[model samples]
Target: MATPADLPDSVYLEIFSYLSVRDRIRSSRVCRRWKRLVDDRRLWRHVDLTLYTMRPKVLWHLLRRYMASRLHSLRMGGYLLSGSQAPQLSPALLRALGQKCPNLTRLCLHVANLTMVPITSLPCTLRTLELHSCEISMAWLLREQDPTVLPQLECIVLDRVPAFRDEHLQGLTRFQALRSLVLGGTYRVTETGLESSLQELNYLQRLEVLGCTLSADSTLRSVSRHLRGVRKIRLTVGGLSAPGLAALERMPVLESLCLQGPLVTPEMPSPEEIVSSCLTMPKLRVLEVQGLGWEGQEAERVLCNGLPHCSVIVRPCPKVSMDWWM
Candidate 1:
């Protein structure tokens, strides 16, 4: 019946900015100035309720009272303070919305049932933090978030997180405008605490780890000597060992390298013995090998020997077969 105060205020704040706090309390009965413009704090910037509703803390006290001055960005997994049954966040409502959301930046917490993250109760004005399946301590998030003098942090996506420790390793060497870091489902990890957290990410270039567990091989060759401005390195060394493939020959501008693993035996090495030990980097172009156990003449002699330059791609894993890459 198009009621809700004849739908204005920019179409009821763009339809109560995508409802779902049980339909913003059943659209506040469409009256009394649309329930004061649905408890206007400019109809809350962006607060998605994570669905499994029943009035999660009265929608977290409607974001800790009267839309805590039009909060910035807050996307949770489900409710109380982050789903999966929602609970931990009541240290006085995370210290009164971490002392009233000073334009809180972006917090997309998924949920893993806590390990740490009181975030000293927030207000560092975060830039981007996306942690899915979080059971974080990340050394109490580098001693309660500093982000290099809080200069609008760059990016951090810890997906599938198992555990992140190594007490700040020099505060990730002072972010200094970090680029991109993604650790996807890293399994059973230890590699000397990811080689001193990879030389403090000295302005990290771009790196991704999927299912890793690296540790020895001279601590992954001293964690590949800080990957000299790494250009792109994705890995899946499934159970990782053998000096973690000799620590990718210490990354000298590693152009590209992707490896997905499980085994083809001899403790898995033959993608032409890992491109003849990364042919001394010199800016490698590309080399992708995914569960190589179908051999194809040793994956075509590890993609035509010496890599000829680089650009090599192999995807044959299909749950391992073909005589297990003879």
Candidate 2:
């Protein structure tokens, strides 16, 4: 009978592609041939270390052993602990990553400590950078010597970062190429900072401000004035004022709008006002309203009746899972 070891190199590689990073390492121990095949650059094109909580030294060892210039994307999870126990990325490790993964375009870090890491040390080829529930200092965001680091970066997602504040937002305005920005669960960002930063990002096309406590109706007005080209927006903010709704109506290219969280208050725009506003938006296609409970049914009927060409969704707020923030 034939054995598994007899499989062709291509066949083995194909099979290995279906395995997770951990499984690939385990399979490498089976034999020297398997180990050699596991080191193929094609297999490490998109590395996902999200399930691992290894220290920086361990991560450096893993990357040096497996990562190559062909790497395109990397998703990593870090351990968040106090003092020496924290799994922070060091300058040396970041420099190694930039050198080893020159082609890396997307990098996502979750629950990481980046207090000591300068953003400039990141791979310059990166186009998208996401930091979730990470510890980032103000200096880290503001630090830039060349102003050319990560020049290709176009999308940035900062979610639940405790240190994110107005100064950080101002610092980000330097990235004029940014197109998609997601700020979720960031309460320190105020309307002034938002307006100031947004006006500089004329290229931004998608924006999501979710679970922001200070984001009120006036914030929407600022977005309307600064981001006239924005096509998709999802806001979880406080009660909507009439001027906010009116400002949104002027957006010539907006296609999708999602209003939820504090937007569901009894003071929300009436069905007639929402329908009238929707009428002015020539490109409006989807309008979603959440957390309205019984009050939403009437708005649903009115929206569906008023705008036959649009998709309208009205429902109570869905329970968010703990992992949603991460």
Candidate 3:
């Protein structure tokens, strides 16, 4: 009778594929054959090391061993401690990654220090890049001499990166294929910077600006004039006034609109004003109004009554603490 150890390598790999990263690591310690089977490149297509507490050297070794040409997505970040600083990502590691994972398409770095990494060190095949609470200068990536560095990049999300500013938006023009952009907690992006940046992106479809002061009539007018093809937009009421809201009429193809964040005490638009302004947008189908206080209900009613052809959703913003960022 054949024993379990006599099973073929393919069978062991099949079994290992069903295990979680932690479980797979545990299973690898079962025997030499199991370890070798676990090390197969096929089983490491998507690597996520966010949950593990690993040193930089250990992470580098793991990537070198398992990250073959087939790797598609890689998420690596350090856990936040009470008072201890997070570990910085090494330039050597990024250089090695660009060489080893040439085919990687998606890269997410959360709470990882990027001060040492160079923009050219990133793999050119990347399609989506997400940076959350990471320390790095946008100039490094945006100022690359070759505009074709991130040729296929479509989406970029920057959340709570204090160093990012309006000047960084200028760098985005280098990415011709960029379509969707999310900017959260970036207070430095002013109206002038935003208008100038939007002027260059004719293909931008989805845009979200949250927790920032970008509210200006001219800014929306600029958006209306430049981004006529925009399909989805999310912004705070404080960022847009009645005229600003009316400017959206220029985008006849807009499909969804979300208005969120705290209402500006005296400048908030009334329910009637909002309804009257939005009526001009012919293609709007989904409208979401959130984070407003008592007035949110009135706005919802007016939207439902005025725009029978569209779907309206209204909800208050959830309470978030500082720990939520972690």
Identify the candidate with maximal lDDT: 2
Candidate 1 regions with alpha-carbon error over 4 angstroms: 1-57, 60-62, 66-75, 79-100, 103-106, 111-125, 133-153, 158-178, 185-208, 212-227, 230-236, 239-244, 251-326
How do all models score by TM-score?
Answer: 0.29, 0.84, 0.81
How do these models rank on lDDT, best leading? 2, 3, 1
Candidate 1 residues 121-172, lDDT tens each? 5445667666676675655557446544445656666666566545543454
The true-versus-predicted C-alpha distance at residue 232 of model 3, in Å, is: 1.1
Higher-TM-score candidate of 2 and 3: 2
Best by TM-score: 2
- How far out, in Å, is residue 134 in model 3? 1.5
Task: Indicate the worst ten consecutive residues by lDDT in candidate 2.
Answer: 317-326
Reference-based lDDT, residue 49, model 1: 52
> Per-residue lDDT tens digits of candidate 3, residues 204-248?
988877777777455567769889888988776775677677888
Better of 1 and 3 by lDDT: 3
What is the alpha-carbon lDDT of model 2 when measured against the actual structure? 0.80
What's the best-to-worst order under TM-score?
2, 3, 1
Residue-pair clashes, model 1: 3
lDDT of each: 0.61, 0.80, 0.76
